[model samples]
Target chain A: MNKLSRVLGVVRNQLATYVPRINATTQAAVAPTADPKVPAPAKDKHEGLMEFFDVKENWTTNEVRVGRSWRKEELRIKSNQDLHKLWYVLLKERNMLLTMQHEMNEKWEPFQSPERIDKVHESMVNLEEVVRERNRAYYLLETGETGERPGRVETNKVGMHYFFKASEHVVPPEHNNHWFKKFGCNRREVAKFRLYYNEKIWLGRLKEKNRNTRHVMKLYKRFPDLDEEALQAEYPDVNLERVKRWNGAQGHFMPRNL
Target chain B: MSTRWYPIYQRGNPQLRVFLPNFWMKLVRPEHKQPENIVRFITPTQMSDHDIKQYLEKIYKVEVASVKSKIKEGLIKRQRFRGYIIKEPDYREAMITLPPGQTFKFPDISTEKEKRDDDEIKKFQDAASQSFDKFKEMNKDRPGVPGWFSV
Candidate 1:
C-alpha cells in the first residue's frame, strides 16, 4: 500500500507539471481574439454548383490566405475513421479548387492561391502513405505476406529487365500464346546480344580502371610529397605500390619518400 | 485497395471497393445554354458514365439521375512564330441531370469585379495627383525650368 502511494505521488507530480506546460504551449500558439467590431466569417451556406466557387466576399479579393497542408505526422495520430472523413473533405476541396481554376481560366481572371491545389494534393498523398503504412502493419500482423500485389523482374522483348506486377488473368500464362509472342524474343539473337552487351560493359569498366591507375601515377610523378595514404583511400581499386614502381612515376625532383 | 488498382472481375468474386478515390471533377459553365436541370462538368478522362454518376451522388451528395460524357479532342494549331503544332490536352465533359425539382445556374462573378477595379483606379489616380501636386510645389521655386533639371 505504501509503495503504491509513492508511485501515485510521482504520477501526480508529473501530471501537475505536464498539464500546465501543455496549457501554456497551447495558449502561446493561439492568436489573440479578434476585435469585437470585426465580424466573424459567416458559415458556408453554398450548395451544389455554388460550392464550386469561393465565397462571394472573396471573389474580388487580390489575395486569399490559407493554412499549410496537413503533415504526415499530424495525420498519423488520427483514427482511421477520422482519416476516412478527412479524405472526403480533401476530395471535395480539390474538386472545388479545380472548378474555380477552370472558371478563372475561361474568364481570364487570376485564380487566388493556385498553390491550394498542390497543398490538397500533398495532404492526400500523405494521407495515402499513412494509410498504406497502417495497412502494411495490419497485414504483417495477420498475414505473413504483404497485401500488395506480387511482382517480379522479368526480361522484356527489348531484352531489358522490368518489374512485372502480376495481375489476375482469365487465361493462364502457359495457355496465353499472345503473351508469349509479345514478350518472348528469339533465343539465339538474345544470347548473342547478351554476350556482346556484357563484353561492352566489361571493357568500359576495364578502361575506367586503367584510367584511374594512370591518373594516380601522374599525380605521384607531379607531387612526390603527395599523401600516398590519402591517394590509396581515394582510389581503392588502384595498386598504389605498383604505380609507384612504374618508370612514369619518376620526376626531375628527388623523390620525397627517399 | 487503392482506386488505381483493379483486379479482373471474376463471376463469383465479391465486388471491388475503392477506399481512396483520387478522381477530380470540375463544374464548368456550359458552352451552349443547357437546361436548368442539367449541370455540366469536366472530369478526368478515365471516368465513365457510371463513375461520373456515382462520384457526384456519393461524394458531393448531389443526386445524379443520368450522366452523359464525351471526349473533346484537344485543338492542334501551328504556332506562327515557332512553326510547331501545339495541342491542348484532351478533356472529357459530362452532362448530369438532376432530380425533377432541382435547377442550377452559373453565377456571374465579374459584376462586383468592375466595381473593385474602379476603386483601385480611383486610388491610383489619387496617388498620382498627390505626387503631381508635390512636383508642382517643388518647381514653384524655379519657374519655367524643366522638372528633370531640378531632380
Candidate 2:
C-alpha cells in the first residue's frame, strides 16, 4: 500500500509539471468590464462602488463620515474576480479622498477623518487575503507546490548575510549583466567577503567559549556531582577539570576533586 | 508598476499590461503653498515621477502637465523609560501639475475632529477628577488613618 501510494504521488507531481500555469489567459479573461449593459457585478465586486464614487448621500456636506474597516474573516469567503474588481474600486476611492484632502490643505481647512483611507486599505488587504486563500486551495488541489513565487535564501554583495528570494529575471542569470553586478553572489564576492566574515565568525566563537567557561565554573560550585563528560560535550571548547579548581567554584566545605 | 520584483520589460513579451493598477495616490495638503496646479501627494516612496504620471493619466483619466517628488522623513522621538528612539514612518510626497482646467478642493477633516478630541480629553479629566473627589469623600470621617494604606 505504501509503495502504491508513493507511485501515485509521483504521478500526480509529474503531471502537475506538464500543466501550464494560468497566466496569460487569466489576465486576458479578467480584463476591464467592457459590457456597460452587463448588470452591475455581484455584491462583493460592487461593494463600495455605489456609495464611495460620489458623495451621493450628502453631496452638499463637505465631509463624509464613515464607519470602521471590514474584518478579515468577513471577506475570506469572497471570490477572486470580485476581489480583483474591488481592488480598482479601492484604488479610485483613495485617489478621490486624496483630491479632497489636497483641496482642504490648500484652503487652510482641516482634513476630516483621515482614517477613512486606513479603513479602505484594511479592507483591501483582507480582500487580497481572501483571494489568496482561494488561490492556495486551487493550487493545492492541482499542484503540490504553492502557486505563489518560490522563495529561498541567497547571498548578496554586502556579505552581511541576508536572505534573498530568487525572482524571475528577463535575462538568464549568466547573460544578465545588470543582475550579476547588483544581486548575484559570485566566487569573487565569497573570497573577498569571506575573510572578514570568517574573522567575525571566530570572534563570536571566542565570546561563546569564554561565556561557557564562566558558566561551567559557576555550575561546578553549585552542583559538585555535575557530569564532566556531558559538560565537555555540551561545550566542546570548555575545560571541565580546570573549572572545578577555580576559587569561585569552591563550595562551603572541602573541594570535591581533592 | 515599478516595484523591484516585477520584470523590467523590453518591447516584446506581450507587454506587462496593468488593466487597473492598484497603486493608491492621496493628494495631501502641502505644508507650503505654491502654484494652484502643483498638487501634493502622499504616496509609496518607491514610486517615481513617471509612475505618478502614468497613475493619474491612466487610472484617474486626469491630464497631468508635470510631476516631481521627494521623500520626507517623519519625526523621531524618545519615549519615557523605554530607552529606545522611535521614528515615525517615512512618506513620499509628490507635487503634480494638473492640466490648466482641472481644480481640486480638499475636504475639512477637523470640524468633527476637534470636537471628538476635546470630548475624549474632557471625559478622561472628568474620570480622574471624579475619582479624586470620591477618595476625599471616603477619607473625610477617617482623619486618623494614613492615605496610602487606609483604602
Candidate 3:
C-alpha cells in the first residue's frame, strides 16, 4: 500500500505540473474543471472519446515525431495496474493513428510517420507478453497450469496442419451439425496427397544437390588455383574430390602445372 | 501473445474478459449523410456489434445508443497497362449512434496551411533559379573553362 501510494503521488505531482499549462484556448473548448486546488477528477470520462483522434496541433503537421516503443525491461518493473492503464493509452494512440490514416487515404494524402503505429503495436505486444509471463508464473505456482487457452494441432481437409484453439459451444461437437458437416475428407485422398507432396519435396532436393555438384565442378575448372577448403565448406554435402574427378572439371585452357 | 486464442465460455463460469484486446477501430467519414449524433467507424471483420459497443463504452467511456454493422465488399478492378485484376480486402463498417445531445464533425486537416506552404516553396525555387541563371550567363563567354578561372 505504501508503494502504491508513493507511485500515485508521483503520478499526481506530474499531472499537476502538466495540466494547468495546457493552451488556454483549447482548455476553454474542453469541459471546465471543478476545483483549481485538486486535480479535476480526471476530466469527464466522456471526453476520453476525443482521444481516439490526433490532437489538433498534430492534425496540421506534415510529420509527427515520436519516441521509440516501450522496452520489455521498462515494462517489467511497472505494476499490473499501471500496465493495464498504459495498454489503454496505447490502444487510444493506435486508434488515433488508424483514424488519421484512414482519413488521409480518403483525402489521397500520405499519412505522416506511418511507423508510429508499428511502435505502438510493438509496445502493446511487449506489454501483453510481460502480463502473460506474470499470469503464467502465478498460475503455475498456485495451480500447476499455465492459464492459457488449450489448443491442439489438427489436420484440415486441405492436408495442412493448424493449431485449433478449443472453445465451448452451446451444442457439443457430436451434435453440432455444422461441425460434423465440415470436419474431414476421405482418408484415401489425404494419403495420396501426402505421398505426392513428399515425392515432390524429395525430387526438389535431388535436383538441388545435382545443381550444386555441377556448380562446384565448374568453379574448380574455371579457377585451378582456387582454395579447395573454401569450396568444401560451401558445399559440405558434395564431395569436392568427387567433383574434381568429374569430366566437367577438365577446362579448355591448359592445366595449371603446364 | 497468441492473439487468436480465447478461453471457452460457459454459463456458470466468470465471463471471459479480454485484458489486452488487440482489435482496432478507426473513425471514418460516413458515405452518406448521418444524424448529428451518429458516427461511422471501420473495424476488423471479425468484430461483432456487441464487441463494438463494449469496446467504445468500456474502453473509451463513450455512451453509445446503439450500433449497427455491415461488411462491404472491396472493389476488384483490372490494372490499366498490365490487364491483371487486383482485388481489395473486404472491410466491416459500424454505425454508432451516440446518446442525444452529442455531435461529432470530422475536422478538415490539411487544406488551409497547404496552400501557404506551397507558395513559400515556389518563391524559394524561383529565387534559386534566378541566381543559377546569373551564374550561367557569367560563364557563357568563356566556354570549356573552370568556374574559378574568372572572378
Candidate 4:
C-alpha cells in the first residue's frame, strides 16, 4: 500500500507539471500593472462595511462617468475560473450600487448615473449566457444531450399547449396518484372548447388577410405607377394580382394599360 | 437559487454546488437604533437566515455570530393621479450580529453633501448678481429700453 501511494503521488506531480499554467497568463492579461512613470492613485483601506457605499468624492457628485458593460466576445475568451471570480466582483459592485441608490432614494437625492446598474446587469447576463454556451457545448460533446432542464409540450385541461418543465421526482408517474388526479382533464369538454378556440383563431387570421388585401388595393389606387414587384415583396401573403383586378384599385386619371 | 437553477437534493446523492450564485444583499441603514455589532441588510424574499449567514461569512469574509431575517410585506396604496391601486415590491430584511468586539457605524454622507450644496448655491447667487450688475451697467446709458432690444 505504501509503494502504491508513493507511485500515485509521483504520477500526480508529473501530471501537474505537464498541465500548462493558463490562470497566470489570463490574470496578467486581464489586469495589467500600472505604468511606472505615472503615480498610482491612492488605494482605499478595506473598510468592510463602507464597501457598500461609493467613494466619498462621488457621494455628492451629480454624475459619475463609467465605461460600457463587458461585451460577450470579451467574456467568451475568459477561462471558467476567471469568469467565476469576475462574477463575484460584478455581484459585489451591483450590491454596492444598489445600496447607494437605496440610500439616495431615502434621502431624496438623485442617484448619479443610474444606468450603471443596467450596465452591471447587462454584463452579468452576457456572462451567464457565455457560461451556458460553454456548458451546452461541453455537455453536447460528452453526453450527446443538451444538458438543459428537460421540458415537454403538454396539453392542459383548457386544451392549450404549454411547455412543462420536468422536475425530479422520487415517485414514478404510475405511483404518483395525487399528481394524476389533479392534472386529469375532461376530454369531451376540452374537445368542444378547442373547436370554438380554433374557429376564433381562424377568424382572426381571416380578418388580418382581408385587412392586408384592402391596404394593398388602396396603395394601388393611390400610386398608379407603384412598383408592383416591391409591393408584392412587401406583402408576400397577399395576392397582388387579384387585388389589382378590383375596381377600387383603379386610379383617378387613366389606366396605365391604355 | 435566485438566478441559476440547481438539481433537487436526494438521499445518497452528491452535494449540489452553486457555481454562479446570483443572490444579492444590499447593506441598508437600520430604521431604529440597533447595537453596534449588528448590521442591517435588504435581501431578496427567497433568502433564508442560513443563506444570509453563509453569504456574509463566505462572500464578505465577515465573521457572523447569528442572523435574523424577516419578510416585509409591500405597501398597497392608491395612485394619486391615476386612482389605481399600486403595490410596492416586498423585500427580506436581515440583521447580522458580528462576533464580540467587531462594530460598524453607518457613515454620515448627508452633511458633506449639504455643505457642497451650500457652496454651489453661494456660487450660483454670486454669478447671478454679477450678470445683473453687468446688464444694469449696459442699460444705464439708455433708460427704459428692453434687454432684448440691443441684441
Residues A89-195, candidate 3: write the lDDT tens digits: 67777888888888888888778889888888898888888998898888889999886877899888868789997775678877887887788477898889989
The DockQ assigned to candidate 3 is 0.36
Predictions' DockQ, in order: 0.29, 0.17, 0.36, 0.29
TM-score, candidate 3, first chain? 0.70
Q: For residues B21-53, could you state the per-residue lDDT of candidate 3 as single tens digits?
A: 888999888999887778899889999999999
TM-score of chain B of 1: 0.85
TM-score of chain A of each: 0.73, 0.52, 0.70, 0.69
Give the whole-model CA lDDT for all candidates, comma-separated: 0.76, 0.62, 0.76, 0.77
lDDT score of residue B82 within candidate 3: 95
lDDT of 2 by residue, A146-204 (tens): 56666767555765656666666666889978867777667776787788889998999
lDDT of 1 by residue, A170-225 (tens): 99978999998876679889888988998999999999999999999899888877
- Judging by lDDT, tell me the better candidate of 1 and 2: 1
Best-performing candidate as measured by DockQ: 3
C-alpha lDDT of residue B36 in model 3: 72
Higher-scoring candidate on DockQ, 2 or 4: 4
Q: After superposition, which runs of candidate 4 have C-alpha atoms over 4 Å from their true positions?
A: A1-46, A210-258, B1-3, B128-151
- Provide the lowest-lDDT 10-residue window in model 2 chain B: B1-10
> Order of candidates by lDDT, top first?
4, 3, 1, 2
TM-scores, each model vs. reference:
0.74, 0.54, 0.75, 0.75
How far is B105's C-alpha from truth in model 2 (Å)? 3.4
Task: Give the poorly placed runs of model 1, Cα more than 4 Å off.
Answer: A1-46, A210-225, A228-236, A239-258, B2-6, B32-38, B72-89, B98-102, B131-151
> Model 3 off-target regions past 4 Å?
A1-49, A150-181, A253-258, B1-4, B115-151
What is the overall TM-score of model 4 with all chains considered together?
0.75
